[model samples]
Target: MKITSAVVSVVLLVSAQNSFGQFPAEEVSRFAIKDFTFESGQAFPTAVVAYATRGRLNAAKSNAVLLPSPYAADLHGYDAFIGPGRALDPQRHFLILTGMFANGQSSSPSNTPAPHGGPDFPRVTIRDNVRAAHELVTQQLGITKMTAVVGYSMGAQQAYQWAVSYPDMVESIAVICGNAKQYPFGVIRLEGSIAALKADSAWNNGRYTQPPVKGLRAFAIHYAAWSQSPVSWPRDMLDSMSNQQVDQFLRSLEAPALGMDANNVLSQAETWKRHNIGDSPGYNGDVEAALRAIKARVLLMPCRSDLYFPVADAEYEATFLQNGELAVIESSAGHAAGGGADSQAIRFIDGKLKGMLQ
Candidate 1:
């Protein structure tokens, strides 16, 4: 294992590429399988996983990269980082942005048919996502193997699963601001979100006719506080927003989120709550053994100030990888440090991805 830190800001020198990499088109394609069986022994008929592809596969079809969606994000969420000269570099490699199962686009609670729709949506794990994504790559895209699987946040969890689930299919992986397993403290935080939703009288047992506005707002407040570092509020946000505006901004996030199904959030939360690459086949829930079994060249990018998935988590995981490098994103932007959301962390993450692809 090797360790490195990126503390300098390269925003000026990185402008041209970042501007060029802003690919706008977000076309979606869907792949479906019948009788999709879940790890929970649950099954859903006609399970579909949606994906968006950019760039052309090389002559050998070996330049495929699988980009899984993070928590509450769709394929379009990555527009800032998926252009010609950007980190993903569509002009150079075939990019496959895989949507997480419960992310509204794919077979989610809001999209599925009756009975299995809404609260009835089946439970899906990280392994299940990797399994479906593997099928899409091999069967639909005709990609034998991936050059690398790249993801951030919850997407990073999927990338870790991809490396372990089908070690031979993935040559490398890039995981940003995520952990191999759901830390107990992390679960407690998510459970708070669930509790807030359940407390809403309008929830009506997940069958509410209207959005649980109050609950969603409460959840948004929770996210505003915990998703970011304590230092970010005074140092970063206050620099751009007034105290009153910051209060309104946090409240505003609830509206768009309300448009989404509560069950969808819960579905994603369940998967994230039990994220353990080791829990799958072969590893049998042994975390250390699963990390060792990953054959991919691993690029572990962790946010220095991320409360949920800190750099310390990456340092510990790197020790278990067969070939791993830990690149520290020194920022107080928290878990969002690497998704091209902020300048400092974006430059570091983009530079890292370029090196990984090369």
Candidate 2:
């Protein structure tokens, strides 16, 4: 399919299912980390990281680009930008799309066995996810340096961590609708969603025999309220939907959340909450110091109306980077704007990313 067509499909899927479509088997793969140690000092005997790749690694291995998945997404999260003639053209750059932990495909609370499964799973930070991806790139893929790290939402958080955690490894980074830290407002928003999920009697503190459908539905509603701009509700949804249609639309959002494992959802949310580049080793908890230490060319793309990661935060962050360019996405699609929610936003983001990659 053409790049534009693929992106349109991605937008539809994201709206309806909160996920991207599947890729061919040949493009998928997995890497295992032996005795992996997390930032929380918890160790797992064998931690598996699932990933998907496209294109060929050049002889010098200098053309590789890392695309980390966002919260609750798999490696296909960046499908909108992965086709030919797109910003991440596979023919030109070797794309490594890695899935985040607790995302079902990778090591997570729902998929693991007893002792470290469910609520007993150790706390994992954004740094831990980045560390595992670093291992996958260096040890598994045999790539020393990556040309760029492109990410959206939680993926963007990982991208920022990559530049800070290993300054010499990544040459450039595109942080789309994401922040270096999970600020106070974001923490409160996420906590509310978590609380809604736990309120279902079926949740049973994450030990339920069956999925907590009621709790998941409540969580989905809570997230939907904040995921889009208030303007979008009246302009895009209310104007287009009848009263019955609005109810159907809401049920669509709940469907995806209901299918997900509660513990898995909570796992990624916890990871998102603890994201702070300032907390990286040697930074002394100084956010500005960590941003200033980045050696990569940084591209900050925060949507103008994104509630999750506001443009104002990006503006402040750009001031600290050694070599950073703040390019605000002019859209009311909120956080989804950076994830190809609309054709115009997709085009705008693609243009910025292409320039940054070049």
Candidate 3:
């Protein structure tokens, strides 16, 4: 159950390497929409959505599997489950990996031009991301239907959104460590992280001349405490740390956050805070009704130790689904369990996904 520092380092290293396009991709492309409209009614000219694909579309174009990026991740977010013999074997299924709107790879506060850049960037919703990905699949890839939509964390939120928003388009969806709605407690956690990032003087109300190192560090510290289980801190960190080494360990945790753009972080956090399947058309904010409307088979995999998306929430949500299964990840890795951070958890997930896809 304990994830040692070495394991943490390897995970970070792999993520850093993947960010540079090291992961396998048959092709990497960007789909641009002219005058893209947000769910909030704000419009941005030439919003670009970045995506990557592996494998070839069969004659019917029916073997497509969509993998949406989680918060702060890119197209390669599902690299661990995609390979020759993996659950989502690229050779067997055409894998369409998408970047989240605010992850910098896609249209984001960091990459967008003025007027709609930085603090002025319009709020993005999980439904908005689904709409964009829908366009990419239908218009660009000519995919009429997807065999599955598999996701973890924020990506899982998108997966649930896809099932409800375009039920007929997705045959199945696997939601890992995410819920159909952003519960009040989850909103508070995200708000706290956002507040910490914006509190630094150098943040300058999102017009920072330089990176807000202090603010980012504070945000990272806050996130680190919640991202993993309380038991993990003692097993993986406190037990291994001496008084003299405490500061070094804390700095290591801050490194990743420091490299991220402040505005980009805020943009995704806002999107996460606003996610709700019921927000889709005709639901009237009725979460249970939305879940009942979904036609796709659902696999709900919530980590037992996940503080952000509790297992109890997933179990309750599963009851509403017309066709859903609840499978808890029994690991102390918390949310990371669903992100392929634990080898055993990854195997369990892959097996479940294989069954779902079958």
lDDT of 2: 0.84
Look at candidate 1 and give me any clashing residue pairs: 21-83
Across 203-257, the per-residue lDDT of candidate 2 in tens digits comes to: 9998989989999999887776676677655434346557787676667656667
Task: State model 3's lDDT.
Answer: 0.85
Q: What digit string (tens of lDDT, one per residue) describes model 3 on residues 217-280? A: 9987877777777755554445656765776767777777777888988899999998899989
TM-score of each: 0.89, 0.93, 0.94
Candidate 3, residue 283: how far the Cα is off, in Å: 0.9
Off by over 4 Å in 3: 1-27
Alpha carbon deviation, residue 224, candidate 3 (Å): 1.7
**Candidate 3 TM-score to native:** 0.94
Ordered by TM-score, highest first, the candidates read 3, 2, 1
